[model samples]
Target: MADAPRSTPGREITTGERRRKAWANWSGAVRGIADSLLSPATTDELREIVLDDAARARGIGVVGSGHSYADLVAPAGRTLLDLRHHRGIDTVDPAAMTVTVRAGTTMRELNQELAAAGYALPNQSAIDEQTVAGVVATATHGSSPGLGTLSSHVVAARVLTADGRVRTVTRDDPELDGVRVHLGCLGVVLDLTFTVVPGHRLRKVVHRKPLPEVLADLGAFRDVHFGGFWWYPHTSQAIVWEASPTDEPPTPPPARPGALLSLLCNNSWTPRIAGAAHYAAAVAAGRGGARVLRRDDALLHHLPPPVQGTEYSVPFDRAADAIRALVGEVRRGGLRVSAPVDVRFTAADTGWLSPSRQSPTCHIGVTHPVSAHDPQGWIAPLRAADSVLWEFDGRPHWAKVHFRTGRELASRYPEWDRFQELRRTWDPDGVFLGAHLRRLFEH
Candidate 1:
């Protein structure tokens, strides 16, 4: 039976295993102190564990390669079901351009398989270590000229509800829209079937330009460019653009240059303990290179170990004004700018809740270096700018940090009630609801 029938003693796990259970992209702040981390490879087994724990009063939380922040997995004390072992591409329909995959499959693995078949996901969020389920559940996105978030590609999915029932749904199905960005509230999404596009080669062109001139030509540049951006907290400069052709090419060998940089920058102790030794090493490698070029799958994403990120999007027209204001506040506040604020453009999508729902938008992403540094004071200047963004009809990124609450959230998303109706039907018991979710949806 998928649902377990008996109570069993909690499994024992070694400390070495516990250390391995931590997040790959997020900080260790939210890690839970769990007695054991069990990884099941199949749907039936996952169901059995959930049912067994529910019957035994052992709190169980599902984890997908640990890509997100917040205490969703910080069990305080409970059982954790890490889904890494259950990772795989379950099915693919070349004719239909769609694929079905296990929830735990990493984006990196998915792209590799898709490339071999001459296909790839239409859009990908910046980081690639996140599980397919984790990315879709959080409504991850990329800077697509026309499409919406990653959830928009989800045609169907199988979610393990709080009661241990596996419900299969599709975009054409009534409950589809709500569950795609469900925050695991509908339950553990065991598998997802989504659309894929033909693989393509990206031509990267990096040039520094002034923000004002770029904004004046935003529409002209976006017409031909697949991805366009302006870098910040280093606002005096902008990363002009990149264009990629949609065609199949010989697969490239695996590369780790970007991965190594991520490791060095994200280590809290290495910078704190090693100090100038680490900085000296980075300098010795030569910091003069800025042209980031890779294949379609590789160019758009990064694999930084978890650091905090806060992103917000306002109307396209208001983008330049908002950025100038935000930067001004940061400077006036005397805040140290470490990571460059990322600015990207995306056209409106069909998804009702995507940040770019009805109009073209400019996304301003604020990232903090996870390396040891004083960042507590940095949040305040961001908070000040957040106030102005909220006034300009800005919507915060779901996966990133923000100070907005559920009450304000409802005002921004017109489809809020319908989403709530669907959430109520699938998760009537609210078993998957957490503090982060409550603040975002269920006030």
Candidate 2:
């Protein structure tokens, strides 16, 4: 028999070693120049590293899979606690339909384990490379009027606070709502228990229609188990996706349309070519078809090309109007967006900092491929679209790029002060604080 890998505490790696392994995020947008990087294997070791007398004043930040496109994990001149090595399921309470996993576990890994145990997450984002803690911390969401964001599903969490104490928070705890989306400010999350359900399957259908037609009857779209759409501004076409529960046996997934066209469109050299092809395809497929697959298979989609963009959550009732306004602005400004505008719906949640808190929300995201020739071409349109969404009282996704300041964000969220108070209580010395967080809180 072989021994399983386990985390163990040891001395911090040398400064030279840290510099040699410089870190960059998934989009290569934010790069870090940290003083040192620590990979503590066990909870005790992590506590020791965080509580070290000399390291306390220098600050500490935790980095997961670095999947976030924002600057949440990049803290210059501070220690980065990389948790990638500390991963795996800890326990499963089948009777209660719950599972506890290390905070560093990725969604893809968790789904496989859950399937083996005849259980699964009720809802999940399209991409699954993000770690459990990272996803929950940022309030990551999928599209569904019935399902809430990922943090809303957390039942309990074991966290290592900034002051070197480990606290177990349950659903009954008052602080759980705030802790669910702590932004790594309150503490270092060790593990989390999420409520799950019996494994099931889903049937997904995709089709194209005029934007006005879909918006006229938005209720029909929201009534499904999961519904979202992509709007092509240039073509006035909408690619709609709706998923529903299915009792049929699982089948092999279908091949995605236009693999070569997608490749060409995503390539930096042929961006214009890609845009033309996409517009033509959307026009060609006036109406689409359906496919049935397992729950996990249906929820996960292929990773798209690197994109720099912003996402905002607006009131559900205002979704159609907001999109219409944004489209008008983009068209009026002559913005050349190569990608479709993504629109998703989510039910209200209880997390204090969740964008969808206590209100049914519609998320609108605009993206464009990174262009080397015209590096800043996407900025103008994105800002213009952002302005339109802002007028509709939209809230920015914590993990995505937005130009909101502390005052602006505080004004939007009623519980902002309470969350700040909790952050102070948990990390008075600001050990876990970073530049981006300071910008959002210190103001």
Candidate 3:
């Protein structure tokens, strides 16, 4: 489910003329006015705020790097805590192969720092605009059947729970699983310690083929270190992206002149002209050869226009059937999608509420740029696809957009009740379970 999207055009927009208290999410999809905004520089300062009775009643929520499309970060009437400035690497243990970072640090910052230290995460997320906490909270994954979600790599964490305590959670602790991907309902995560891999290079090879053919034999590339595909809607073309660990020396893409202008040509200029040029360029291109990059940059994608995105996971064995059914359903519904359909896969994980829990999974992501003419046009097609994917026991990616409530989702997860029970134990007073979280976890 790791499709990289750059931050929104203008970041989070502030509304409210009087004091500009209202905030819009990265995609401008969710907007609300927080009762107050708080910035805590250090864990002590944050803890002091948590100790104050005021924080509990306000139902505080942390705003990460503004990457999530869901309402998870909308603190409407509640308090919004900004941690953008509260970030930096704390420690790097080369012997233990672990790195400790402040919870507010962005994936970009983390990766740069790790590379400098000769360490790296074994897998790369499509998007690293999110904070470590936000990324782990939603179980953001990478493209590898052998590697699970990024959260699965966290070995330990320090959390400020509802009881006004700074607790250390480790692999030995039962609460660690819940902490791995609880949608920030457990409590405010102060920091995390993750196992790191040695700095390594990955060689990515590109191939183009018909969509139906790729779908029919998706498992052929299953053992590749990292693999995925993008299917252009209404077109028979699909691109297979495969990257594997390479000891060969890195051969990064050549530094070209006017890089910025070239980017603008693809992301901005192409879309404005009906993507005819872009489509022509892509279809006319060959294998596009191969390039090597650090793990952090391996699967990162070029930016697209502001878009609404969502994904669902089906069992690896059932993925082909599920995707075929989804395509047929969308065609029957007469829904039009201009952007390509992104399909990725990940190894099964242990997180209690993880979509891929208990089974290796295939993730299919759909996206469409915001249309001023028809703002909510994507919803109908996604809902229609959901009806079809649900037949294969699809589990929606928590960080993406979806329309399922907890009632409809209870039976899909094995530890659903245990996760809820832990939420109550961690935040019994409901300081963290605001309306958005309540609907997903309670209702």
lDDT tens per residue, model 1, 361-437: 78887655553455453465456656756777899877666788888988998888888777777667555565457
Provide the overall lDDT of each model, using Cα atoms, as 2-decimal numbers: 0.64, 0.80, 0.76
Which of candidates 1 and 2 reaches a greater TM-score? Answer: 2
TM-score on alpha carbons, each prediction = 0.82, 0.92, 0.89
List candidate 1 segments past 4 Å from native.
Answer: 1-25, 34-36, 53-59, 72-74, 246-295, 301-306, 334-336, 371-378
Ranking by TM-score: 2, 3, 1
Candidate 3 ranges beyond 4 A from true positions? 1-20, 254-281, 284-287
Model 3, CA-based lDDT: 0.76
Ranking 1 against 2 by lDDT, winner: 2
lDDT of 3 by residue, 1-443 (tens): 01222211112324454445476677676779776666666666666656556556667788787777778876687666777666989999888899999899998899999999888886767877879988999989988888888888999999888777888999999888888896888888888999999888889887778879998788885787898987755555677888887888888673342443333223312232424533543464324568898877877876555677778888899999987876675556444455667889989889998888989999988765665676776576666666677788889888888888888888899999999898888788888886877887767
Candidate 1 TM-score versus the reference: 0.82
Model 2 residue 397 lDDT?
Answer: 87
In candidate 2 the C-alpha lDDT for residue 307 amounts to: 69
Tens digit of per-residue lDDT, candidate 2, span 1-443: 01322122434545554433366777666777766677777888889878775566667788878877678886576677888667989998988888999999999899999988888888888788999999999999987789889889999999999888999999889899998898988889999999998888889888888888888877775688987888876556788888888888776786664666465334433335545666776764435578787787787666777667788999899988998887777567455556777888899999999999988999998876656666665566567666778899899888877877889999999999999999999899888888898988999
Off by over 4 Å in 2: 1-19, 256-259, 263-275, 283-288, 372-378
